[model samples]
Target: RRNDPINDALWDVYIARSTDGGTTFSANVQLNDTSFVTPSNGRLGEYLGLAVDSSNAYVAFTSSISDLPLGDVYFDEIANSDIPEPGSAILIACGVLALLRRRRRK
Candidate 1:
């Protein structure tokens, strides 16, 4: 993510991947900008969230610095064979199930 208040309060996000590990990175691609927020702060940029599932990665970030009421979410999926270990998968599945069960009781 990159942002500059001097550049007309522009903020940009990019999704990158490297199959060869951290040795290389793909070109940056703009995701969203201040237009996502009405009357943008002209300094819209901060706070980022990133996550990944079995087949995809996701990113979300805030577009306003003051009186933030909403945020933009983005996602991308990559194809690869590097699967997680069975134990890790099981743990993640159990965690999700637990969360669901808890929500059901509410």
Candidate 2:
């Protein structure tokens, strides 16, 4: 969940990928080019994640890009191999299922 840091009125969705076991992550990449805005009252309502196959990653979310007051559904996808890297990755979410196992210094 992102609130377009650049534009207060325009909301955006971004995702970051980690290739080195979460030690580092790629810079946040936007899912789609569509311009999205929070609901009039600023509630996203509901959204869900799709799946990541061997070659591609997919995501489904709700947005106000097409629908104004009520909002609508949308999707974004990227190839697995294209995922880049970041200086460091330390991502934590509320319902995170798993995290990279950090190595203990000897």
Candidate 3:
């Protein structure tokens, strides 16, 4: 990223996925479509936060745009075909079967 005078050096948010138990990682994809300017007053933070649901990964970070004087928080989510846990899959199957049986009784 190139340095900037008005805003801090231009920054971008990226994300990567690992499927083979951290053996290999997917290509880094920039999450933020727009610009992500760093805070000028002080350090933004030590690390970024990431949360993974059953189907998607969510990331949060600090970013300051060109218009605002202060920095603001930003977040993004990316979807992936995550494998469902065995217990969860069984629960879903049971729920579907119960619904079907109730409909048949009607």
Candidate 4:
């Protein structure tokens, strides 16, 4: 997102994401805002990039002002699966132990 001033100056910019495919978005937090000091009169903007791999996804963006020519860039990565809940590791360990015992019995 971006806000442009009347004179074409950029003021501020923000970026956000949702791990659940946009069902719910994270806060519209400011990733970069050149006009942070004087927000009301300044402008803002953002450029977003997205990529995915078999196990992970990534999002990136940059925000800046017209005069600055360079903006802060940000990136985030998400795993394909939600983080396992508590006790999940114990269950996995038990399952592996059971398999090992079965193989030893044979």
Candidate 5:
């Protein structure tokens, strides 16, 4: 989830694992090598796909990176062991509750 009021094009792909049944998540780990700007139609991009097996996760997504002006699909592989354990707590907005934003100071 992004809350930046500036630089709307600073789109980056990330993955955060939830260990407690989605009640909390590990800090997001960036999956993309470069930042990009997706289409401005309130969508991150097209063909954002995920395939998971017993030991790893695979991701395929699109990006229009700064260096690569032409958009391209990128693939990433993450080993299940590489995902960090959730040490702290942060709720990722999901489902019908996403529209209800809240504030919490650290």
Candidate 6:
């Protein structure tokens, strides 16, 4: 979530992980790579959207960066060990496609 005032202030993005069925949460982990500063009349809305798959968690939000004049949408993905590397992912995709084609031919 982003906390910003009507005027300029330091905006931040954070993520919390839950391991015990939402009974408790870990400390917030800052996700933004660089500092986000609120621009004039900058409003980042209320809450962000989070999606967690089998091996990765995706966070989507909007932010007004320091250099950018306008706000931009950002997507960050945190992958676990189950996430395949680039090469492995590509190979898996190709294998799936090949299997689909063979099944269609039969």
Give the lDDT of residue 104 in candidate 4: 18
Per-residue accuracy of model 3 over 67-87 as CA lDDT, tens digit each:
667767777665654322110
Arrange candidates by TM-score, descending. 5, 2, 3, 6, 1, 4
* TM-score, cand. 4: 0.31
Residue 92 lDDT in candidate 4: 11
In the range 1-106, model 2's lDDT, one tens digit per residue, is 3454565566566656665667667776666576576667666534545455556666676777774568777776767655555512222221222232334459
Compared with the true structure, what per-residue lDDT tens digits does model 5 show for residues 1-106? 2533475446667766665656766776777666666644546534476655556767777667645655677787888667677712222121112111123358
Go through the candidates in order and give each one's C-alpha lDDT.
0.37, 0.56, 0.48, 0.36, 0.56, 0.48
Sequence-dependent TM-score of model 6: 0.56
- On the 0 to 100 scale, the lDDT of residue 72 in model 5 is 72
TM-score (all chains, Cα) for each model: 0.44, 0.61, 0.59, 0.31, 0.66, 0.56
Error of 6 at 89 (Å): 26
Candidate 5 error regions (>4 Å): 1-5, 40-42, 66-70, 87-106
Better of 3 and 5 by lDDT: 5
Name the lDDT value of residue 39 in candidate 4.
29
TM-score of 2: 0.61
lDDT (tens digit, per residue) of candidate 1 on 1-106: 2255454434454544444433544544444534343234433333455455546545555554345565444443333233222101111110011110111135
RMSD of each: 11.7, 6.6, 14.1, 16.2, 8.9, 12.9
Clashing pairs in 4: 2-44, 2-45, 3-43, 3-44, 11-42, 11-43, 11-44, 12-43, 12-44
Predicted model with the maximum TM-score: 5
Worst 10 residues of 5 by lDDT: 92-101
For model 6, what is the error of residue 62's alpha carbon versus the real structure, in angstroms, after optimal superposition?
A: 1.1
